[model samples]
Target: MKALPSSSGSSGEKEASSSLVIALGSSLGATCPSEPPMKARRSLEPVLLAPWGSCLLALGAPASRPTRKSDSFLWPFGMTTALNRGCWHKSLAMMATAIKLAVRALVEVEVRRKSERLALSEAVAELGIRDVRAIGLAHRLVLETLKRLNLLDEVAKAALAGEGSLEDLGARARAFLRLFAYRAVVEGASRRELASFVLSAREALGKGTLRPIERALGRCTTLSLDDVLASRSGDERLALELCVPTWLLRLLCRDLGRQVAIGLLKASLVQAPSYVRVNTLRGEEGEILASLEQEGIVLEPVEGLRHVYKVVEAGKPIILTDAYKEGLVYPQDKASCLAVEVANPRPGQVVLDVCAAPGAKTTYMAQLMGNRGLIISIDFSRRRLGAWRKLVARMGVKVAFPILADARFQLPTRLRADVVLLDLPCTSTGAFAKTPSAKWRLGPRSPKNMAKVQARILRASAEHVKPGGVLIYTTCSLLVEENERVVEDFLRANPDFELERPEPFLGLPGLRGLSKAQRLYPHIHECDGYFIAKLRRES
Candidate 1:
């Protein structure tokens, strides 16, 4: 068989060359269809049942034996069939193109938003991307770019030094350049792949749109991220190297000490461990574990926490398994589970969950209560509360009621509770590994501003706690302003609440004499940076 042409004179030519190389690499030496190549190609066009399958086979390649996994290439578009060699290569090309376009669109929109932002889930849904694999890949690329934004910008600035600042580029151009830089520097994509990516981007974004950084993209391939960082000094160098803002670094250093802060920052750059809590209301832990093991999902019980396990390995996404569909388990972090355990809602008790949405804590509380308690889950967003309702139903939680109201304001009704849970919103520095975009969205004033809100909510929610009842405060944030300071201010003003050690304590003591509270760091705990304080209201 003749090899595909390799000369790249236009965007289409480059794309063809790239696709041919991918086909030659992945499909050439593995297996070939038993049928003749021509006959197989003709059959695949109609039989493959995917919009891109025929286009892929039409590009011309040898036939190969089909497999179930290969068929999943068309799964996103409602096609499920074994693909011949030619269609497989074309599927790769089409999926790659789709991912590139999706990433470009998402990054452009985010960059244009300035300080305001859209959640990645919202962006993915808005794009209406039907391919699961494409959605996953595009989401990964978007996060990688955002997580390493500072480093990517530094590299772009160095490569395009005399050209112009990244801020000066058009939104589309900036997005493309950042994506290219991440692929080139971080992913180490081949020169050929990089060239193909750039050409495809030009075609999609318009030739004139990418004109400004065309030369810079070429220069980015030659630059080294380490060399860029070595040129800076102190926190600035650390910030650029870790792809975090200098202000955030300084904040961590000042609050947690330079050594501890550096460790936390470095840990935050990597992926956090996945954990799931077995739904005791649905089944026993032993039974659930046996069922999950039958499905090839391995989990190890987290030390000190009942019903929570760290995912050792699952052949696929844990959420897709039958056990998950049956609501035998809920995907949650160990640190988060620790907070609910500290709250320790008892059967027949009245519990108020403030700012509870998506109901991870609320459902867990219901489980601990044996579904025999009155639990009111409150949040400011009606949309999020709707999701909370679904979660409640899915988890077999019958004792929880969803309320749409801000916890920072007065309660909707005069309903004091035996236990009040306040998981307030803050800078979310502790969860950077899981939600990297939050790091970029935050500014120096964010912690201070968020502290005020936390304090207000803490005060208002405290009213819902009956005298002598427990009030648990939690945040997925490491900042002292949001964690200890707010609690301290509330304690000083209220005078009726006294800090108490959270039972089944697992994390280290809180900062600045708030030793009774528990604090979890990503590096230290192998979980999200979290803070939990249990206080009892005194009459």
Candidate 2:
């Protein structure tokens, strides 16, 4: 919904940046295929990714990354100066290998035009780097770097005065600089430590012919984040501190109040807890818990919901374990589980899932329905729907049938359903912690533009809700334009629909007196920022 951010490249360079964004959803993955990929590009444009399944996947979910207790994950604001088990590796051999390969991986990642996302963990896993820690180290390096990218660029541009601009550099050079900035600013690496990592870039950036890169690296070491902040105040300082765009941060401060907005932004930097719902379709709840416990996944039951639990820690990456393969557990955020609970579909009912893909909510809905109801899942991308179908099949969902259709226009069928779930695409403002790249991908007008798309989808979806049936509208966004405003526009046009209280309301009341709608914040709820409203067709 937002245009990709890039330097003022040539027409060709602009197209290439746009192309890579369309081809790949994240540096690790791609969502939709809106444009063809070109082999070279320095900038990236993010497409409308299927946010259902990989809600946390894009954020990260390889067990090797290691997290903290209570799903209140304590990811460091910046990595440590030297080697630690979690940050850079102590072994020079491993650090050199990780740095060399990571730089190459990042450069290639910029130009790749894949149809689906390749998780950084998975990408590193494929690099023939035989060591497990090396792969994990590379993923952390890239992931944290991308999260702080905006701030990195701000500091970089200033440090680059008279040295040349990041936009003017080649893709490899730009990628290396971003990596170097992450180490310097985020990790607070020393001159000696920075030098160690810089040496590895020679192998990735033209094999010892990187005089320009080396010269720039010298400037990067002298840059201090504090020095960068000294000249700014208000949201300007907070923007760099949080590594979010000043525009978005300004909007949040205005809407949520400065302190509340700052708290939310700060929480996003710390990875939220990974949550999973026990698939009752595969086995009884007790048996599934026992199985997960046997596999060393320590889970704490989340209050106010059934079947959803916070994954405190896991012995191994949950996906790699038999439980996931067997579809006994689903990796989901607790806030996502809350949206599904509010929908509360029943057995034998006909449900329409608009923009459903990658099948997180569809599968969960089927699990609650006892696989007895019919769910017609509609999504724009055939690729995403195919993914949904496969996921449902794995999760033992027999009632879901996928249909390829866009929700922005009229439907292809005349069927009205007992429930209509429109978890349509939005700015993904709420899930920024999970996918930090999204923060930079958006523009000032992005939310207002996305609200238009959400409004259209909501109008079309409401038509399919039978009289007295419920239409559950939800988005992983905090912006009112995409949530409350869209709902307000729909309610004004369609007088028959009225907001109803969502059950087990765990979040704060929605703004503008839409108390029937609930809002969840990462700072307060320890979950993704999300909005949920269940509307009843009152005719």
Candidate 3:
């Protein structure tokens, strides 16, 4: 092992001497001869009296090994002066213990929450762990465990057959078991590797508390995921295979054809590529591209879009890059950029962004408007609008004002705008690749419930559009109820507004005779699944 950097000459010498003592003790224990050559005895003297000698003694090295001024000691193990093997193993074990504890803590919090699901990022922030690498590993473990939660539960059930159901296990115990089973079955960890992880879990969660799981872990390793997937058929089989809920799979099949639905489901299992829009407020396209490239972030311009680029390679997290910190680039998805493009807000138009928070589309619209137009951004939650304020400020957007109001009821201001953007909340089925947790959180009634909310917001937003002004409705959802159905109902009730083809026509035509509207699918677009429709108030 490489010696750690020392503070000064004296400390360096001491560390070297201490390392030597540890090496000698490991090679020759208490049975070492009492007398040695004069040179060896003097060399070993300072090491024997050093503080590290106590550590060697504690690690099962004979207590007398450090006390004796030995001369006749035999270097049976070649007197290697590297770090002790047992100490290295113990250090690794401690690291694993910390990670398991962090994962368990996050999982427990998520499981216990009733109304609000704690985001992984928020959970990780609360951990207060100082080690960046360990935090990243724990974050990855939590995500993987949650992504395959249903499958893990099934595996755990089979493993715990005749013992107790997975529901009977306590939250912490269930978290630990899900994590372990994911590694053992999905990751294909060996029985011995899993046993070590379980031992670490036992130390963190108490041996008695983890006893039932310890017995079940052996059975967990013996099970095959293929067998579990093979047991189900059709939608059930697809759900297990893709780690999606059966209800979601059936819904997708009903909306999109079976082949297309399966494709979307499979695509959701993979991580989506990062896409960003150059902040024209700060720099020109060429300037931002050159700046990001200098930072080792190469971006490919998205086809048919000017400002949007797919991050081909980012040396680090793109958000942390100097280009990003300087507010030269805003990470917005390609499909999302398509909606703002279709809206085509001019430099001096008044745009109202209903349901604007965490302001991706709002900022993008501001960028397109050349920071010269008035944008009234409104959302129901003040907390989310606070984030919008930060994003607007970061992007140097001066023309946008944020309002805290529920768009479903009415707009905060009486002023009608040239363009009204209603990006309503709905079942986020399209963006599942990026947000797997949302898949399990949604239920059968989610689309219908969300459609009702979307319809109210759409009708309220329609009242805010000026004569002949465009009302752009969009959502990151593939469900027809939230997309086509909502728009169809809105147009039926309001004769003045009619659906028109979104400009720069990117994405496939919408379903249910709403062909003028556009839909982007994850499998086809290589971006989040999304829907965009442009309606003109003819009056």
Candidate 4:
């Protein structure tokens, strides 16, 4: 929760700035050509409020005149606060109480009826917020918290015993759950504040309070807000521990076994390490590391992850560093960087990154090829591609050509590629730590649905690969259905493509009969849960 220092007028700013950039730049010396000034895209803030109207404003989105389409986008930006002259929304201090309530309510409902997406969306709509992104964020927070607490069914029964239908109680539960989550998880507000936050919740969910809930709070050691946060053994206690829901824990046990699930849950609670890939197209790794050292950013080498550095300290957002602004380095996950290594892009190789957007892998592959080959990056989303363009511009990627197209359909007539990287979308179970909300939105049916879509995307991408070229399939999900199982299904249907071992060895070997496929997990490898396999076209 520490605020970033402004670069304006600090006496030591100049010296600190250069030192920081140098430390960052040293990692990019092997790939990039020259050091450049830093420019950063601001990350969305930690606290978000539901908007009063449809327009959604990003936590740090600069103040400006309202637009006509604002109503349609409300759920994404969140509801702004009325108290601070439009200056303040919710702050990060209220987490303890908000998270606990949100989890308690969400888990209770999900365990009973399931499938509440539409009801939640409608309730958020009434709140006049249109920003789907913020809605998604808030929804995820409640869902993840519930899953962590093992009270999904308990909370649902408490929230909806009388409502009798998903459509009837869904919105009411979501609104109430959001308030409770905000008070517990994000605001860390105490029981008294928790009572206040649930004012709206009380009106919508008028069921009699559970006697257990009453006794649990009555036994609190003190009435003070901090005491409520520190109280043990209620649903709130579970929120503080941040454990995965008992059901999810059981599901994980069924798949990866109890030991691995416990290990992963422990890992999920740990703060994700910050890692960035030095743009090899800009300079060599040695020179980049030295340059970054001169700039004062502290970094440590990650074992087995080439061109990746973990940030220990920083003077400014790395994006503002001259090295980053000039496309000398890009922030990417270490596991994702490994996928390109498996692709083995040669200098003249023609590569295709299907589903490429926000361009991390696209740019990384271009750098791997020394900017000498053609790389066509295709995605169905134009807006996402526009964002990718911004990254390409910032990262100084020159060889990649981004196209707007769906991977489930036929590729363009001239779409053949030497290396096709099919990083198709999946359940994203591996990214639970980064995206805590998916646990709520997901179900047993998620993998089956996602696998079907992935199979289509994979087949389309595979068709575009040139004879004897390599096709790399990957996902950020650990599910066997989404990972090895999908690959097995594809392999059975396509005889010309043979599975190949991953290069540079970033992940552990895969499971079942697809052991040649590479899989990385946060619990085991301390990286995003990822699955990657290389397939060679025998021709």
Candidate 5:
């Protein structure tokens, strides 16, 4: 699981970022007993599903102001003042109001609009007013809850529904109630709990004269009720019920078979497996696992890939561990690990990792080479490469070097390598569960545009590959144009390169005449939906 890129923030900005966290804890307010008994967390099985669930809940809770006695003296004086002077319930109301405003700003505010600028800053400022950690926890819950149940759109829609809309009638209750029902109907939340949540929300919001708010709540509730009732039986069709744009779902269903399409959609709702790749350069797998266990982290060994493990109990930020900081392990998907294997980098092999930023596979290849081979890793962004360098150094990888250059263009110097790994950029449809933002932001034109880009990269990289060397193409995408279709077109134009079978374990075969290429689906594989093809240049 690669970390998503986030916006840059300052020390002050980091403090301001707690607005959402503060909002998340507004329900309990100051009445939160000092040292309230922590509820027993759910079992951390199936790719750290329980920890991931807790993460989301934490994100949804409001942030809290720092207590005077707490460590970390950087806590804002204004926040301390708020805590010391205000009534706890008054703080709760303020937190709720701030969250509502922040959510609206997040969902509806446009980046280019000046009118939204103030709202965005206001939201950020709220974070500094309370413990931002609680907000982060709540946000995590919102994401995990939706992902695990394939209910992101349903929840988002309910959250944003307007007054007088069908969704509004049902959502008019308190915020938590509406959210609970959305989870219940769309994500398999229990009915009794959902009912209780609904009642609580109603009590919080009260039967007010705010018609727009009422309408919004009503529409949200009604839609959620319909979805829950419709999916009561857990039929694949019912379970895969998505609130996606009709055209998108139609296109996806057309490309993939009905059952497989539904499976892909449903799988996106399931929490992604928290897979970690041990840094063989630092220590063996046993040593890394032992270190992790010492910190209360548990791992489930994946069947085929010995280096990979499904994180069972991920405590706090696992990346913060000294082992991780020292580059002992990295979080990577099994499907991604397989891509490098398909490339088959050897000890003395010279390879090219195009668009290799944050260098997960590049380092993996370096480790496979025992740090003896040369790997030219190229990407256009220096900022991205900085992160790659950080990881490379941490992992003790010496052979791979980063090149800041466009992937579409040929390498500046004339050189060929034994293997060329092209993990081309695509629409990333296969990663919907982990990144719901892509679902809403990506357009239909993405596949065609990305196909052209992959073609250019393949053609350029082919010129550099030594005769008899392999050129492996891969994408974190399931779309045919970016996967099978791109390969088909490339093979037709470049007759000298033939698609070759991947070694060790050959996954499900490809489409059309490219059966040698492998395609993996998240639902079936319990990994990211991915595609890989190994092509060798004729000697």
Candidate 6:
């Protein structure tokens, strides 16, 4: 096998720093707002020696002084090496090897399991007790690699030049090839950067494990986007250029029209805006704004929505701030906030939050209800409820009571509520700007399949809405199958419910004559793609 090219001395530091932010920011988004030069959080985060643990330190989280619990909230942050390059717990040689191995192992596991969340959990578990700054770096690396995986895999098949298929390669080799290809082809890593990666992988994974793909990496680095696109055309060409799936691209074109679909597809390539709902329950908005401002967190209020603000800039990742940790604000999408506002739950009303785990909406409903209503939070996953418990506690949501049960069937609750909020699951095509990996996991039939589940949950949730009460159905999906069609089918069977305009309508009118419903697009709103339908029971 051909060996990796030798590393050159680091030159053009100015160009490298500016390009680093733009390259890594593709999927890591608001994690680093413009990636201004900054330091690691003041305290030294524990840098464990696990393979992935070492990788976590690759981005310059000081491997020095032990951090206190109060100082140790791990969250994704800017991965600029300029931050902690001087304070590594180990030698650069070792950290480089750790980085290579960590990416390979995580990518391999993610490919095998088909779940980025699970893959991250395994890596984090192996990390032991360290600040997960490096883990966050690793996660961002994996996400970007995965986000552009469709394009990477297509180029790989061509780069092999028929000697072998990607499927024939060993899983670890496949993982390594994809990771480096992403760095070189997509992010345009320098020869020094690519050489360091190869040498590091050789040391960590052994030359034997990566030997099969060395030549492929060499071939891949020489190829251009046009070279990869030469053999493809039309939907296929656009899909490759956009790094989206062929079938999904066709669907978006058909549903959203070619121009609008292209706009939405292009939006997924860049960072999405991050938003937070100020929890007025904990403190007044004015005082909270001053505190966040003092901490170097900047904000711009979203018009038409009370207590919601777009993060204009931040000194660090929002989740790491004292305001976020204290639960003074909730990181929620603007589309999500619009749904809660549409529901407009009143104080003292009984509301059932179906499938409400990790409680952004549930907590927001409490905020609107002024903590006076009873919100019965229902979800099937015990693990999710556990998280929901912590989130609700942090948000100071006193009105919500959790129950573990599937909303697809009859809910366990016997009492009816004045409001039933169904933030049902979907293919998540609209939220791709934030979670681009989800688009790859979906299939052509994925929407219809999810629609079936959503239909069941909606019917069950509709069972709990009292007469004259409101039933709000929402999804982070632009497809009609999951939104208007489901609502249309529900209305056909249950004539007692009539569609009503959501106050402060923020999106386009729904399709198929469901004009009362609303649809929000990322291209139009600069937010997650969403569909919201409100039905008032007339019985």
Clashes in each model (backbone N, CA, C under 3 Å)? 1, 8, 4, 94, 51, 2
Q: On a 0 to 100 scale, what is the lDDT of residue 431 in model 3?
A: 77
Per-residue C-alpha lDDT of model 5 across residues 345-391, encoded as one tens digit per residue = 88988988887876888999998898997999987655567767877
Query: What is the C-alpha lDDT profile of model 6 across 1-539, one tens digit per residue?
Result: 00001132111111112122222233234453332211111222222122432433443333453344332212223233332333322333443543553565456445663344444444445544133344445555666666677888977886677879999997777877787667656665544355445655666567687667756766665766666777888888888787788999888888878898898877766667778789998999999999899888889999989888998877766665688778797677898899999999999999999877768899999999999979999877665667678888988989999988778888888868999998787787887765565777678888898888899999988988998999999888888788888998999999999999998797888888888899988878989999999999986
Q: What lDDT score goes with residue 366 in model 6?
A: 97
Order by lDDT, highest first: 6, 1, 2, 3, 5, 4
Question: What shift in Å separates residue 494 of candidate 3 from its native position after superposition?
Answer: 0.8
In terms of TM-score, the best-performing candidate is 6
Candidate 6 residue pairs in clash (backbone atoms < 3 Å): 56-134, 56-135
Model 3: per-residue lDDT, tens digit, 151-254?
Answer: 88888888786788888887777878788777667766433344345545655677566666655665665667765665788867768777888988888889
TM-score of each: 0.81, 0.80, 0.80, 0.63, 0.69, 0.82
Ranked by TM-score, the better of candidates 1 and 2 is 1
Q: Is candidate 4 or candidate 5 better by lDDT?
A: 5
lDDT of 2 at 466: 91
Candidate 1 accuracy as lDDT: 0.69
- The residue-level lDDT of candidate 6 at 416 comes to 89
- Could you give candidate 4's per-residue lDDT for residues 1-539 as a string of tens digits? 00011222111111122222222322322122121111111222222223311111222232443343332212111332333343223322122223333334354444443222322333344444433223334444443343343332333333333445324444434434434433343333333233323332333334343211322222221122233334356534443344554455566667787677667766664445557889877778888877777777778878876688887766544655677767777667788888887887988888998878768888888877887889898877664566678777776778888887777778874778899998777766777665454565566676788888888888888888889999999898877887788889999999999998778776778888777888888877767888899999987
Worst 10 residues of 1 by lDDT: 34-43
lDDT at position 517, candidate 4: 88
State how far residue 83 of model 3 sits from its true place (Å): 9.7
- Give the Cα lDDT of each candidate: 0.69, 0.68, 0.67, 0.57, 0.58, 0.70
Model 4 poorest ten-residue lDDT run: 1-10
Write the number of the candidate with greater lDDT, choosing between 1 and 3.
1
Tens-digit lDDT string for candidate 1 (1-539): 00011222101101112222212211221121111111101111111122222322332322243554433232222323246434654555554555454455456446543211233344434555445444444544554567677888887887686878878887777877887777666655544345445444544566687778766765676666665676799878878776789988888899999898988877766556778899989998899999999998889999999899998776655666788778898778899899999999999999999878768899999999999979998877655566677778888999999887766678797998999998887777887765666787678898898888788888888888999899999998888998898889889888889999998899999999999999999999999999999999986
Score residue 236 of candidate 2 by CA lDDT: 75
